[model samples]
Target: MRVNFTIEGPPVGKARPRVTRKVTYTPKKTSQYEDLVRYTAINSFDGCFDHDEPVDVRIVAYFPIPKSWSKKRRQLCLINKELPIKRPDIDNVSKIIMDGMNPKMKRNKQLHRMVEVMRGIYHDDKQVTTLVVKKRYAERPRVEVRIKRDMGD
Candidate 1:
């Protein structure tokens, strides 16, 4: 089975977990982005992805050209002559999206509430046998995600 979806707006990288003497938690920005990814994935298709199958994931993150860049540079980026080589590294972007789609269960600690139960794309990120990630520039910034079962050779 294969699933495909796009998360609109600027792509966000996974932020490092904050640690205090008392407890550790995900940053608000990271948490919010993850929620968006999860919500989009859950609603993208009619059926849930299988749990035990090996999968391959590919992500392409598109960034908007900076206003400070000259017209020539902006044109280059738009045509793929130049790429996004700044912050929000590719690895971080991929990590957040994978975590967002994986099934999760946690107990104890903060008393807010547990994450809502939903059919997830896969059992865990570890089940991903292949991953491909890329970053580019676009007129409308967004992240495109593709997940598919891996049929081994």
Candidate 2:
């Protein structure tokens, strides 16, 4: 899955420059399931500013989930008991994928929805933003799923 983000800013001297960050995930073909994620720092600052000028900088960064690590396979035992896996349900799948692994308070809803769709449990009216598939690891019989998110229009 791929997502693109755009940022706009005025000239550096006249106003504070805007900085945006982007990350991309590229998966490898080997069985290790290795993935390469790239981080890019784009400088929207115009070159008009003088080197000696003291400029106030405010950075706006957008960090997206890595593509390769987005989906992971693990034993179903890792999932929370509250999550429903017996029957195929989008909401349950979403909850399990998004909140099952982490004990954190907040969860990423968009990422959950995306995972649900990828599992063939739900279909979005619009195109799917991202997709992560869940399956058993080669050496283990345990089940696993992938988690990913995209900026939807």
Candidate 3:
């Protein structure tokens, strides 16, 4: 089976967990990005990969051309003459998306209980055996993800 979805926004990387005196927490940026991904995934698919099934994923992160750059430079970036080699490393970006597609639980401070943040697309990110990630520049920023069951040959 195969699933494809596009997230319309700036692509985000997974930030290292932040540690306070009492708790370790995901950064706000990362959490918010994950939430966006989760919302999109839920709306995009009706089923998910099984626990033992191997999965393959492809992600393409598109960044908007900087306004500070000259028009010519922006055109070059849009045409793939220049790549988005800046912040939010490819690995980090991949990690965020994978994690977002996997189930997550969080403590509900007000309710004093654990609540499901998302009913993910898979049991775990570990099910993914192959991942292809790339970054490019586009007129509008977005992230495109394609996922499929891997039938081992």
Q: Indicate which candidate wins on lDDT.
A: 3
The better-scoring model by lDDT among 1 and 3 is: 3
- Give the Cα error of residue 151 in candidate 1, in Å: 1.4
Which window of 10 residues has the lowest lDDT sum in candidate 3?
114-123
lDDT of each: 0.87, 0.24, 0.91
lDDT of 3 by residue, 1-153 (tens): 888999998888999999999999889989888888988987899987898999999999999888899999998998899999998999999999998898878889999998877689998899999899999999999999999998766
Off by over 4 Å in 2: 1-90, 101-103, 106-128, 131-141, 147-153
Cα distance off (Å), candidate 1, residue 121: 1.2
Give model 3's TM-score versus the native structure.
0.90
Per-model TM values vs. the true structure: 0.89, 0.19, 0.90
In model 1, state the lDDT of residue 6.
Answer: 100
Question: Which residues of candidate 3, in runs, are more than 4 Å off?
Answer: 107-117
Output the lDDT of residue 107, model 2. Answer: 37
The backbone clash count of each candidate, in order, is 0, 3, 0
Ranking by lDDT: 3, 1, 2
Structural RMSD, model 3: 2.6
lDDT of 1 by residue, 1-153 (tens): 789999999999999999999999999999888888888997886665566778989999999889999999999999899998898989999999999887555653576666636556776788999899999999899999999888876
